[model samples]
Target: MRIGLFPSANYSAKKDIGPMKQMGDSHVISDVLALGKGVAGSQQVLCLDGASILLRKLSLDSISKVEYENNHFCFGVHFLLEGNYSFVSTESKSRLNITSGSYNLVQWPKTNGVEKLKGREYTSIEVFFTQEFLEDLLGTEYNSAFEKFDNTLVDKPKYLWNEMKPIPGRLRLLLLDILHCSYTGIARTNFIESQIRCLLIEVFLGKENGMEQIGGEATLSTLDKEAIDEVVSYIKQNLKRKLTIKELSEVAGFNTTKLKSCFKKVHQTTIFKFITQLRMEKARLLVLEENYTVAQASYEVGYSNPQHFTVAFKKTMGYLPSLLLTNLS
Candidate 1:
């Protein structure tokens, strides 16, 4: 919802023409619709199986704009087909702006924020998944790509990624079909439900086009994600040390089992593997950017035996460490 050229900044939506169509799980609830003075467009919604799909096509007058506050434990994605928006966080004082043809996964536990919109034409689709529904859908899988969501159970909202990504072409077309669905009654409900599942697959597990990581959805609680993130930061800071699972568990305040599961879930790899990855990445940087010798680079990341390090480097990097040295020679 937006506020612009209205009677007052406090203008609340006083009118909801209500239920233009209601059949089975499909409810054509036209809200904030009916081209008013400053704004023009229709806001329709589809609800099914703990998910809500909001489809809006709006056109504002040249001087019109919409400013609305966001306050909820939101876990979903926002797709913008047109217009630009700026979101301001009241708690962190962070600002994010997104242009057309971009989308972002939102796991806002409590976004005490405001979103501003100003454009001649605005179009967007929002898909929201309930915590229970999402968890059920994910089914306790290991190595899910997305991170944690903003949870109502948490005291306050922590870090949420506002990174904007381009909308995949196929997903965009599917969204358009949803916006202009011609099906009615039970068929409409079934169609929308199928589309929702497809949306999830396309955004989070589309191994076909390699868009699985594109949505950047991570599964875990807010606290667990933060704890894991903290552990990762510490690992980065102390890469030269021989970090162990016990030490990381202490750092994360989680037991070994929980720590291992959560870490793998967030990173798509075990803690040890993640550490190896970090070490290999740092060693590569040292060789390529700092011009460190193979031995020096290996030793710098806690590899005492250069031979062992060489084997590991070759296995992880798909090439021998001495090749880098050969290039230098």
Candidate 2:
């Protein structure tokens, strides 16, 4: 049976909690209505009842007055909410210099500077599952399985080293559905269960942990940036050479897994796609500039068979080589 275990809120049966208010020295927002205004510098993860959640950033200095306001979206568990939140820093800096994609947890230190953000819209849906809930799933084998899961997530609080941006359209819709079922008090339907499982798979397996380009932007880590530069130079210098995962990994001096991940982080696509795109672009130029025949260009670009070349070119460029020539002519 599918179930949602989430944070509790201070929102009452009656009375409007209104938009989140900022208070104290830490410029953090909470589901104050449901979770109550946390004591300043509280470290615990507050659980709010029901699933609906919304949060806006607030300045801790003047939160008691509610005078300051800032522009930001309200995104969280079981709801689509957006609004402005504000807090002005008093010590030295007039405004707190938080950038996009910034997040903090109980353990991890907050990463500073705009470079970490890369201008992406920051949003996250925190999902909490109790050990008891997981134990129920494993039944007789629950103990061992639960231990494994716990070990993996033990460092979860600080695991936000990289942001998981949601993909446009498809994945976002999937998240919306999950939140809807969560707050609507609806039973976990079979279809919804599949969707939830799909999300989990994406998180566990998808490149960059299935992070999509929120606002079509990303923040690259230093390791990712270095790996990207190495991979790009290798591809450009050896476009006509046969390429493989191992070779690419070596060129980047990163393990195969890390190379693939860094490629996705910087380029927002896989190495295979990057190489294929480069080859296809070069082939198009050869056809346009040198007037090479499809067969000639195909072999010159490293494809053994003209048919395979045509298939690859069409898949990437959405036009047959001949058609590309026709358009150019």
Candidate 3:
């Protein structure tokens, strides 16, 4: 069924309205609803399982109105990597503006919308999944994770729209991995599916547990917030240095007790875990993108022993660094 705008009888048939065709397991109909002398470039890839794992990058050369319609019931988590766009619901007239480093969730039965893109390049990654797919991955835990939508009737699809929210650091890193993945064919598809499942679990679990508002509370004083930010910056900048909690505490000007508490409050992770996460992420990028060997990447990320780095990388990323290189090759 045609879900988006129908071709108007008045306009000439020479106009381009983007692409409307079957994509993976779903049908996507996108049209240039309105154009102000702009060009749009987009790349879309669907996983082997059809629309189960979809990634899209879009760039607009000028102001334009884009409309999208989907014929299936699925949930989408969109990460606005760059630029901003305004979305107006065609059915409800509700409006939302999504900016970089933020994400929004939308559920089906509510797919039609008009997107107003500013004259700038914008990149976004959207991962879509059906309820059955989520259930298969999450099992009984799914109900608890998505308790907010528990009342949604299966027989009558409901529109669920979650306005933009700040992207958590862990989820951001995963999205980056997906964006930078080098594998192709079935390997790429498998990697994407695994990452999507992890992403979904993290998002829903964060929502369920109120992890989204990590540092947005009056409990953290301004000084404490500043200190936490400083500590985070230091960790990122000094990934090659062996940073202990005591050093980090001094860097933040907070005592050990206060340092741990404030760091957890601000980053939703302990100082050690947070540093390890950053190190692993950096190491992954180095190995994948910079052509760094496992030992070299480990040392670059502050791992004194290559064996330790290998174990830690495997534990956190679910595979050894060498395996990643082999897959890419």
Candidate 4:
């Protein structure tokens, strides 16, 4: 399917943005959309196994609203990284405010719209996942959340997850990492693939936990948030070893009580619970991908007793490790 970007209201006749092209071991496409006066924008697109990403940047001296043929598209996240714009759905008569440092989930059917920009420049990244891709990733776990998006075409377009939310600090960092990625060739693909998966998990898991990125999170100082982020990095690197909240507090230069509060504020989970989830995830990969036995996987993730690991695995994954092994084809 082709998607078009137009500089004016004549978008009803504008055609394709061109086909996605692949090179070597990765798929990426780069293009420039020239709208009206001084409104030339550069865009980069990357294709994964089941989803596509679009990173767009534009600068203008005098701005005019740009229209787009919002044909049938995949469900996705819209990350507005720079400037400000509001999308006015022509048919639905609904307006979506897009501002710098804000992100939201967009699931819409075929509807054309005008993008009204409020700043000198605009920069954004969109990650769209096919229905098949979402279903395969979600499995039965997110069945209820998955039902939020409607595939049916309607004369008036509607947004499934319409709340405009501020982008979390962690996700902001990840977006910059992708934008500033310096890797070459296949390593670039691997880097972006891993980053995308982590990003998707953060978004989806937040929904599963019934947690919103509350305004209280802004109460954390920049230095404190960075300190907490560093602690999380440390835990992941040392997951196989014994870890303690006291040690993590020292790492963050906060006392145990402050450490607990700040960590939960930033991550929405306790430190120890986060560690257990990480360990179980690692053990799952070891068993399913590396063919490790359940006992070995358990030991590798820092569990001394396989029985305890089995119980934890069922709680996290909703099934026994041995069962997953036996069922693998």
The lDDT ranking, best first, is: 4, 1, 3, 2
Candidate 1: tens digits of C-alpha lDDT, residues 136-197? 76665413635443354543333344455555445665766566556667677668767866
Clash count for candidate 3 is 2
Badly placed stretches (over 4 Å) of model 4 are: 2-26, 147-154, 207-329
Query: Which of 2 and 4 is the better model by TM-score?
Result: 4
Each prediction's total of clashing residue pairs, residues at least 3 apart in sequence or on different chains, is 5, 20, 2, 0
lDDT of 3 by residue, 86-118 (tens): 767667666667666467665655345666656
Model 3, position 47: C-alpha lDDT score: 36
Candidate that would win on lDDT: 4
Taking all chains together, each candidate's TM-score versus the true structure is 0.51, 0.36, 0.57, 0.54
**Residue 31 in candidate 1 has what lDDT?**
59
Clashing pairs in 4: none
CA-only RMSD, every prediction: 16.7, 15.7, 7.0, 12.6
Q: Choose 1 or 2, whichever is better by TM-score.
A: 1
Please report the candidate that would top TM-score against the real structure. Answer: 3
TM-score of 2: 0.36
Pairs clashing in candidate 1?
A: 109-150, 146-217, 146-218, 147-217, 147-218
RMSD of 1: 16.7
Return whichever of 1 and 3 wins on lDDT. Answer: 1
Q: lDDT, candidate 1, residue 198?
A: 73
